[model samples]
Target: RLPVRVDVPVEELTRDDGLFLVGTPRGVLRARNVVLASGSLNCPKRPPASADLPATLRQLDSSAYRNAAELEQGAVLVVGSGQSGGQIAADLALAGRPVFLATSRAGRLVRHYRGSDIFNWMTLSGYLDVPRREIVLPSGKLPPRGLLGATHTISLQSLSAQGVVLLGRFMGIENDSLIFGDNLDEHMRFADESSADVKRFIDDYIRRARLNAPPAEDDPAEMIAPRLPSPPIHSIELATSGIRSVIWCTAFRGDFPY
Candidate 1:
């Protein structure tokens, strides 16, 4: 086997005399070519607003959260409406713990559609094979992957149905309250439309290719969001609220400083 190094983190990379010099805690390695294989989701990105939270509350990144039982007794606030945030909030609610979920603009995905898994349709419809250059949106960023549960569909509305108090985008901390934006309805609508857009794209592809796919069917899980009696909470007092811990599922970034 080729020489291998385990548990040795690369500290820096430089070029000298047309060769790459890699610095690590073990030693320096000189090579003709180097591939920085660190993954995009390797570094957890904590929200800057978290700094305003009082030090009494425990803060944990999405990666460090194992289960609801490990948390202190009281309500839990989950930030970000992406896959990690949504699922963790659901898990906490199901465990009989009060949950407050701060929503984001992440899209939702229906796991199964038109008598087939969404992943299968994406593969057959060539949606997954699109070049990265062609898929970047007007905002100069790639469209994010839609949020879905491990075995089914999940959405902010669904979480709300499960007794999880839905809140708008987490802004920052005020005097004694956690400030939130008043765009919860907008975010929920965006997630619904995004899922519909994907299903429509798949439908058009099937028709153009003359494939004998089954007729589109409504997914109960996707349609499970019930109408709310009032708008979601815009701000919450952390002290008055029974919240004791917060799980930050605000996503991650792959940053290379060296």
Candidate 2:
């Protein structure tokens, strides 16, 4: 019945019993209850998901490739180096497949690194007066559970040690291969594990804080260090399986085209 309108982009799926949607630059469109299987904002340089395509195409979005080959015969490229990208790339590489990870920024470490997790560190130290604390995280593609990131930091460290190759910057795709703007491969070859020293020091801090529990001295910001660098995403290459899948992982504006 609604053949021609099937191709249009729906701006908003209203909350009413009748699903009301505003079309892109057109007008309002409606359905019973709209389901938003539609992916992120559109870009001209990427491909939509297609089965039998290269996993690299699914892995790296538009930032890496204009289009990817779907035969799965060539190299797989994992874009980005934040916890997700790094983890993905490491998994691919360890599988004995040729893979590459593109990163626009370098990953960082906390100033005071400890073998213990941050939550434990916080409790053992004087950062939090209560046993539990609250944290806020940026809202994104992930489903909303609460306000903050609660994952343990160990996952990132383990991935870095697993041998994921890190590349710097996207220079655009060329010559059937993904390339970088700079030579970061030689430097980021391994994770910074010596950070254990930082962690051990935190253990010492907590021990001292426990002895003074109430207030021997107020905690100073200078005493606690910050996190080390980790890479942020620019773009990705999803064209490894033969079909290029382009995804834009950048921040979005409040886009409404009604």
Query: Runs in model 1 with CA error above 4 Å?
Result: 129-139, 227-231
lDDT of 1 by residue, 1-258 (tens): 979989999999999999999999999999998987788777787878888889899999989999988999999999888889988998999899999888888888888888889999999998789898897888877665567888878877788788888888899998889888888888888999989998999999999999888998887766785545375577788879999998998877778888
Model 1 local distance difference test score: 0.86
Q: Tell me how far the alpha carbon of residue 131 in candidate 2 is from the true structure, in angstroms, after superposition.
A: 20
lDDT of each: 0.86, 0.41
Cα displacement (angstroms), candidate 1, residue 156, comes to 1.8
Off by over 4 Å in 2: 1-73, 108-115, 122-163, 174-177, 183-208, 211-258
Q: Score candidate 1 by TM-score against the native.
A: 0.88
TM-score for each model: 0.88, 0.39
User: lDDT tens digits, residues 59-175, model 2?
Assistant: 444334333343154555554454445444544556655555555343333422334345466566654463322432253243211111133232233443445444565556544
Going through the candidates in the order shown, the clash numbers are: 0, 41
Model 2 residue 48 distance off true place after TM-score fit, in angstroms: 15
How many clashing residue pairs, candidate 2?
A: 41
